[model samples]
Target: TVAVVLFTSDLRLHDHPPLRAALAAADEVVPLFVRDPGVHAAGFDAPNRAAFLADCLRDLDASLRRRGGRLVVRTGPVVREVDAVAVECGAAEVHMAAGVSGYAQRREERLREALGRRGVVLRVHDAVITAVAAGAVTPAGSDHYAVFTPYFRRWSRERLRGTCPAPRTVRVPDAVRGEPLPSRGELSGLSPGLPTGGETPGRERFARWARSRLAEYEEGHDDLAGDATSRLSPYLHFGALSPVELVQRARSRGGAGAEAFVRQLCWRDFHHQVLAARPEASRRDYRPRHDQWRTEDEAAEDIAAWREGRTGYPVVDAAMRQLLHEGWMHNRARLLAASFLAKTLYVDWRVGARHFLDLLVDGDLVNNQLNWQWAAGTGTDTRPNRVLNPVRQGRRYDPSGAYVRRWVPELKDLDDRTVHEPWRLPEDRRAALGYPAPLIDLADGLTRFQHARGRGVT
Candidate 1:
């Protein structure tokens, strides 16, 4: 008997339930990945992620070869390709991890229907992409938790399934056709500092980072200049790293830092659960503020300035520029930058969400969209009217201006106090710096935001 394992977001071999289940149920297993055109059609195959995914595929194939098997790559519509492969391989079962996005839900339904026509059983595994399954725990009278604190409490108490060991040997049927693997070099326009992908590098990074930094994450993750947060998001986003394994590893090294890190992981699952319950929330507001937001056309120049990292707010610009250079940004930076665009600028949150999706290596539909909503006062945020003041945020998180200076070199010569507000410099010095002045006065922007929300200034 033969089984087919369809690799989607959950790419790594360790702790993979679908692959293990398939391997156990069959004499031979086909580790298949379909490069779905639907993903491209949906605008997910952005250049940075495409490059990172290419590296992931190449590395996955190499890993499989070392284990006496090889990954089978296919292209076209996902269901059609998956079915065709199942038929060609004479597979009795097809297994995959459950996904949260609307596209994934539709794709899963289509795959089940398509495969069932040919007598192949489709099995979907949970807790593969997320540490906990999306629908695993819920409050009474609710399909999902709307708040993170209660959700985190319930989520932490739930027992995780133990990790699976990588198979010592994987038997694969010969004569399975596959496309040529993708090359990272062939991908262009990637961020100059994009991290390498694949399970090997991801594991290695975690090993070193966890030992040195996970212990300090609680106290230091927000220190912009320290760069203290684990840069593991891309790996997690790609499923090159296992969330379950990460949770377990962090828990074993228990402390405030690990607890903080685990809370972050719980937040990831929280978003997944919310997204699963309401897939439409990906594009629409989970809790609409009925905000009269500026459209892309109405805010064209401001949008351009924000995207180009020239908004004249040092912290906001630095964060945006970091995303351009590294395809990632610090968590604290993400909040303030998002707040600037969605609240301070009073532009539509979707506008900033779309831009981040276009560039961020870790741009996930579930987390990215919801987080934007939180910042824009349109989601499950309890304090919807609260705004992130970038100037105060920069002073607190990047005190001494090293982070701003690192990304916005135009302020390298400014004193600590003036770096964050270079418009405060003398007229000649400010002009000499060649940096734009504050795009809009903070007080004016705040007043505009509060008024737009139909509230008097708080």
Candidate 2:
């Protein structure tokens, strides 16, 4: 008998539960990746992510070849492709990792129903993409935890399964047909500053991070200009690195920084569990706030200014510019820009979330959606009414204003305090610099948001 390992988001060879299980249960295994047109039709296949995914697929194929196997590439609907591969290889069992998004859950259900009709057993593995599987820990009453802190406390106590060893040999049938690996240049509209992908590159980064960066991550992660945080979000999103292995290695070091980094990873899982339970959170508010979100047309000018990095707030503009250039933004910048859109402008969170996903290489359904909700005060934030003042946040985080100067060249000559708010400069000086005035008075936006929340302006 043969078994099929259906590759989805989980692309790497090491520490993969579904792949390990499939290899052990059958005489020969088929490693299959399908390029579903549905994802492209839904407009989910952004150029940066497409390039990264191509690199991942090619690297995975190389790894499999080293183990006496190769990846079979197919292009079509996912369920039909899986069935065709199963029948071709004489496979009676199929294995895949569980997913949290609405599209993912629906895909799984369809695959199961289709495979069952054909008399092939389908098994979905949990905790393959995450350090802790969703729904593994729960509060006393709710089906899912709406709050992250309490959920994290419970998650810390749970025991995660040990990482699986990479197989030395993975035998594939000689008759299996396949396609060549895709080239990055074939994808269009890619960001000029996109990073390289694949498990090989990811593993090298992990080694360097563990040796040097991981220790200072806790203290330096929020430094906007320092660029010190681990840039592993894309790798994690693409399954280039195993979350389980990351946690294990971090725990081995056992320091304040390691603990802090582990907590962030836990935050990633926390959002996953929330999304797994309520996929509607991807679009709707997680906890309805009865918010009178401003119309897109009404906030069109403000949003346009924000997106083009002409917000007149240097820090905010710099972050927005970074996203435009790199298809990625610093974590702290993400929080600030999200707040600027949802709270400062009183614009809908969906608009901002959609824009981020369009370019973010690490644009995950769970983290992107829920984090946007948290900043919008419609999700699990304890202080749901909090607003990040761009000026103060910039002054605090980017003390040197180097991050701003790096991305927004117009503000490069401004002095430190003046960097945060260029409009404070004399009209002649500001005009000479060619910087725009403040898009909206900071206090006016704050008052508007406070009134919407049914609270007096601070």
Candidate 3:
């Protein structure tokens, strides 16, 4: 019997549940990937992510070939391509990882119905794309946990299945045909500092970073210039790295850093479960505050300034510029930027989320949208009305102003004390810097937010 392993987000060979199951259940397995036009149509295929995906596909193909098989590529809507491949390969079963987004759910349903009509069974595997399946554990009387603290408690106690090892061999029949693999060189507009992708690079990075930096992550993760946090996100985003393997390995390493890292992963799982239960939260407010948010028309110049990284707040600008260059940002930086746009600027969270999706290589519906909601006070954050003062945040997180100096070169000559607030410099010196003035005064912004939230404008 033959099986078709439908690769979606889970791209790598190691610790992949769907691939393992397909291999065990069939004599021959056709590894298939479909370049769905729907993704591009939905604006999910940003150049940076598309380029990274090309590297992942090529690397996956190379790995399969080494194990006596090769990946089959197709282009079309995912359901159509998958159905066509299953029938052509004479596959008795088609296995794929479960997905949380509404689009993914709809695709899975379409795949199942189409494949079933052709007498092929569609098997969806859980815990392949994520470390734990969404809806695996729930709080009392709820479909999903609404709060991270309680969710984390339940999540910590829920034992996970052991990780799968890579298959020793993958056998493919010669009759299957596929398009040529995509190449990074064929793409444009990628962030100049974007990291290379694929399982090999992912594994190597995890090994090196976990060894050299994981131990100090607890202390250094917030140090903007230190850059000590594991930059494993894009790899994880593409499924080039398995969350199961990562969590297990980190837990075994056994330290406060590992624990902190594990807690962060729980947050990833938390958002997945929340999104799974409430897919519409991707676009709608999860917890609406009746915000009459500013639109592009109402706040065009401010929005433009924010996107261009010239809001005149050194730390926020530095974070935005890093994202523009690297397609990634430090976690702390992301929070500050999100907060500045959603809270201080009082623009709609969707506005900021869309901009992030356009640029962030690791951006996805669950995390990007929900994190924006959290910052905008429309998500599960218990303290929804809180606002991050960017100046205070900068002083606390980027103390020496090295992170500010690195990206805002106009302020490079300023001393550490003044780099974060160069507007404080002597009038002549500040005017010479050529940096834009603070777009909105901090006090005025705060009053605006308070009034919008219906608190007395004190």
Q: How close to the true structure is residue 214 of candidate 1, measured as C-alpha lDDT?
A: 93
Per-residue lDDT tens digits for candidate 3, residues 210-249, read 9999999888889998899999888988899999899999
The estimated TM-scores of all candidates read: 0.99, 0.97, 0.98
Q: Lowest-scoring 10 consecutive residues by lDDT in candidate 1?
A: 449-458
Which runs in model 1 stand beyond 4 Å of their true positions? 455-458
What do the candidate models score in CA lDDT, each in turn? 0.92, 0.91, 0.91
Off by over 4 Å in 3: 455-458
Q: What lDDT score goes with residue 19 in model 1?
A: 96
lDDT, candidate 1, 1-458, per-residue tens: 99999999987888899999999999999999999887899899989999889989988989999999999999889998999889888999999999999999999999999999988999999999999999999999999999999999999999999999888788889857889987788878899999999988999999999999999999999999999888999899989999999999999999999999999999999999999999999889788767888999999999999999999999999999999999899989999999999888999999999999999999999989999988888888889899888989999999999999999999999989999989888899999998998888888888998887875223
Question: Which should have the higher lDDT, number 1 or number 3?
Answer: 1
Which 10-residue window in model 2 sums to the lowest lDDT?
A: 449-458
Clashing pairs in 2: none
Candidate 3 local distance difference test against the native? 0.91
lDDT of 3 at 361: 88
